[model samples]
Target chain A: MVDPTESPATGSSIRHEDHGDDLRTVRLAGRLDMLGMEPIALKFTSLTASHAQQVLVDLREVSFLASIGIRSIVSSARALESKGGRMALLVAPGSTVEATLTSTGISEVIPIHTEEAEALAGLGAAG
Target chain B: MAALTPADELHIQPDPETLRTASLWLAERCRQRSVPQELIDRLDLCLNEVLANLIDHAGPGVLEIPVELVLDPGDRRGGTPLSLRVRDGGAPFDPTAAPSPTAPTVLAETGIGGLGLVMVRRFCDEMHYRRVNDFNELTLLLAWPQETPDR
Candidate 1:
């Protein structure tokens, strides 16, 4: 059976693919805001508690990032960090996530990846 | 000399979905009164700002504390003005006195926080506050465009 926590929105396959070795990948799209973000946060919370290495959030498909969405990402990052892990993001070129980060000064705090492979490679947990 | 609607004093601490439903109702009320879309949009953004701020700063209560929204169609803008005060009992800091942020360089995150007040300022004329007793009295003032003389 497919684990329910791994899937995001229905009809669209928003999968958090397990890369094993404590690294995971998730894809996002459309507008990510307060309404569509709680579940994503819950999933990250669940995974990060058990695995204490790192989680890669892929915003390559996400168009916009709101304040609420940023809150969730940061909250999850702190949760993992407490357990000796970290969070990085894979951002698409010219996406709003970059502006949101830089504007909020998270580009200096929240690590960014231009490509998914690069993020996994950076974690050195590449599978 | 007109009386305020009964909703003038209604206070509800609602979750996201219920809060959204209530917001739709509020929008319909504004639309019925011909409030401009721009003003309505601002009101909606104001709701998001206060609610998100409350959640961020006002949790861990063991039991869910009521996130209060107090209505005071209390004749602020003559008879047509409805007033809303969304208060967060969290950390007790006044956003009114909080420093401003217009560009990226002006912001510094103590950690994971910066954008809420930014969006809030973009949407409202002013955020008023007074610390009364122990709770934060955050008053977000929004005037309906229909109520404006030249709007």
Candidate 2:
């Protein structure tokens, strides 16, 4: 769990790790609402703005995900997709990740799974 | 015939903390009324987005708004019309009349600086606007929040 004490101004935290060739993983937690969506958007924009080719957003620790947060994710995904890259969201069990994915109608466009491993594997295979 | 309905006005700074707290409190108020999930969902979204925009554009000032909640048996469907009137002492602008982004516009795709009022108008039943005494009154009405059936 990302300590709320040290979280960003939006009260959302970002943790990224390089998975494989041009693949990136980013973890997000805490309430991702309007105020929180700001930093999240910047973080994502910066991450996909780099030389990275693929980005996977991990929301396993996210407590709440709002439309603004969804917009950030979709924006980042579109940016990557424009470059022939891919964006995937890793959602944990009982998380509203499925609804967020469905709300944006991105589930059909992107891949989501119950576990990070499953989501990463799906993305790895898709990529 | 007389009924007991509660209506009150609140004044608070447009600070983000105050705005979020007020909206969250309003959500709790809706829950206490046992509003259905559907109504609650809309209220939750509208409350946050509306207030966020209010504080952002309205700048730092006292938000003089009236919140009127009525629990009426007028509708047999167990839904009561919810009225939320937000009057701000800010610049003269009506968001309801704002034009929506053009279809699939590449600009809208960025999704960084748009879609707040659009979503509210899309989800709410009716939004009334009036400017009086140098105050912008935004009367928002939504389909009644589902209430519990009389036992």
Candidate 3:
């Protein structure tokens, strides 16, 4: 379990690992509501701004996601798109997070994959 | 009619930090009632959106007026529905009046605003708003799924 104490923020913690070939995978855990979106949004925007290639956000561990959280993802994805980069999301099957993304039509704008390998491949193929 | 006590109530300052506190209070109440995780997630999401909207749009006078959250459960249509009433004396605003933004098809046209209200409406089964005595009261209702007996 990713501890919320890991970050100074109360609701979320984000950790990224380089997946080789310039692909970055970010794993987010905990509630991604208004209180949680601030720090994570900054980091996510920075990652997409700096990388500008392929960034896969894995939300399988995320227990809750609100509109602010959705805004962060949309903003980051838009930022990447402006620079000809791409953002993909890994959402667990049948999870509430997935349902929220689907309901907001975000899944249509950004590619959503249930498997990490597929998300990486989709992003890889985009480049 | 007699005044009824809420199952749980929270008085909070209209700020970003208090959003988390409110969620925790709801989570604790749900835990005590053995609410399912999925339903709990829906409640948390709606709570965050509603509270964030109040904090962002409700003006500086909102600071003087503490936000109130009241949680109660009642039987509705043969299922127990959880009700969350958010009362704020900040300003007169009706979220239901806000136009729902259409989902953008293209990434470049995607917007950040108005999506919060959309999520609040999408997750909760029912939503209502009223201005009473200079207070904005928004009520969100979610019907809990019928639980199956253990085999």
Best by DockQ: 3
Q: Which ten residues in a row have the lowest lDDT in candidate 3 chain B?
A: B1-10
Fraction of true contacts kept, per model?
A: 0.18, 0.07, 0.82
For model 3 the TM-score comes to: 0.89
Residues B58-117, candidate 2: write the lDDT tens digits.
644445443222222123254446666776676677877887643332422544454566
For model 2 chain B, where is the 10-residue window of minimal lDDT?
Answer: B67-76
User: What's the TM-score of each model vs. the native?
Assistant: 0.52, 0.70, 0.89
lDDT of 2 by residue, A1-127 (tens): 2222235555678768887677778778877777666655676677755553767787888866666776677677776777778877778764444554554445655566667777677777767
User: Once superposed on the true structure, which residue ranges of model 3 sit more than 4 Å away at CA?
Assistant: A1-5, A8-11, B1-6, B76-80, B147-151
Which of 1 and 3 is the better model by lDDT? 3
Per-residue lDDT tens digits of candidate 3, residues B106-132?
A: 989988888888888889999999999
Q: For candidate 2, give the lDDT of residue B39.
A: 60
- The best candidate in terms of lDDT: 3
CAPRI quality of model 1 = incorrect
User: Distance from true position, residue B60, model 3, in Å?
Assistant: 1.1
Backbone clash pairs for candidate 2 read A10-A36
> Per-prediction RMSD in angstroms?
7.7, 4.9, 3.3
Query: Per-residue lDDT for A109 in model 2?
Result: 59
- What are the TM values for chain B, all candidates? 0.69, 0.73, 0.89
Determine the backbone clash count of candidate 2. 1
